[model samples]
Target: MKYLVMVQGSQADYEAMRGNGSAQSPAWTEDEVKAMYAYMSAINDDLAETGELVDGQGLGEPAGTRHVTLGEDGKAVVTDGPYGETKELLAGYWVLDCASLERVTEIAERVIRCPQPAGAPVYPVVIRQIMEGAGDDVC
Candidate 1:
């Protein structure tokens, strides 16, 4: 079965991210960015070797999300950027094809231990099974 592992962070935890401070601080140093990429690459390699990795990538910060809601009139109201509390922001994700939920959980446990930028605490990953479906409708 296919599973999506979503990485999320709390507001306080995200605020503690060291490299680039949220619009208030400078960008990450070369060494810091390099270290983070190295860690991610290593993890990707491990996943590939284990035949669990379907596809994955690191995502930019959550400043580009858009939110859409319905007004009282039932018209669509669109808002720019992250509309939810920063504490519930999604960081990144990985899609994996695992043999079972137990295996997926095991993989997530390892992913949770992957390295992060200095001062950036390890983010938590939530694993969810993807149900088979037709077109856009899930079964």
Candidate 2:
């Protein structure tokens, strides 16, 4: 089965990495940033060798996000981010193809160990199985 593993965390975390803001943020050293990438690459290498990793990528911070929704008049409405009322957003995701739910869960567990901000708490990873395509109908 194909499962999508989503990494959920604060968008501020990314900003801090880029040295953008966060008065309370610790100094992100150059070595630490390189090490973070190295750690992530190692994880991806392991998964790729096992043929479990299908694809994955990280998303930009929510500040650059444009949230769109349909209005009552069926018009598309657009709004900028730094959205309110949510601390956790989908930071990134990994698509894993594995045999069982247990196997997929294991992949999600591994993802939780990836790099994070200094003194950051353990974040959450959401896993969901992708449903097969609708049967041969083009309606």
Candidate 3:
């Protein structure tokens, strides 16, 4: 089965990582960021070696996002991102072909332990199994 594991962030979190501290969080040092990147890379490397990693990527800041919807006239209506400074946004994800939900859950648990500054807030990692087809199951 394939599972999608995700981690969320807010603009505040982004700013803090870039050395702009928010009232609720401290600025991350350069070393701290490097540590985080190295830790996550190690996990991905391990998954790839185990033949479980299908795809993975880290997203850019939410400020650059654009939203699109179909207008009443059947035209595309577009708007900039609505994520406020503190609003949560999808920050990164990994698509893993795993043997079972329990295995994916273990991976998600590892994601939650990614390195961060001591005062940084802990975010939850979400996991959802990818359906193979329409007849597979309804989520």
Strongest candidate by lDDT: 3
Candidate 2 residue pairs that clash: none
lDDT of 1 by residue, 1-139 (tens): 9999988754343344544455333345667667666877887898899998999876655566677899999999988764454546677788998899998898788777765544555556898887766447744
Report the C-alpha lDDT of model 3 over 46-127, residue by residue, as the tens digit.
9999999999999988887888999999999998875465468899999999999999999999999999988888889999
As a whole number from 0 to 100, the lDDT of residue 65 in candidate 3 is: 81
Ranking 2 against 3 by TM-score, winner: 3
Among all windows of 10 consecutive residues in model 1, the one with the lowest summed lDDT is 10-19
lDDT by residue (16-65, candidate 2, tens digit) is: 67765465444456676687778878878888999988998888787887
- The CA-based lDDT of model 1 is what? 0.70
Model 2 whole-model lDDT (C-alpha atoms): 0.77
Instruction: Give the top-scoring candidate (TM-score).
Output: 3
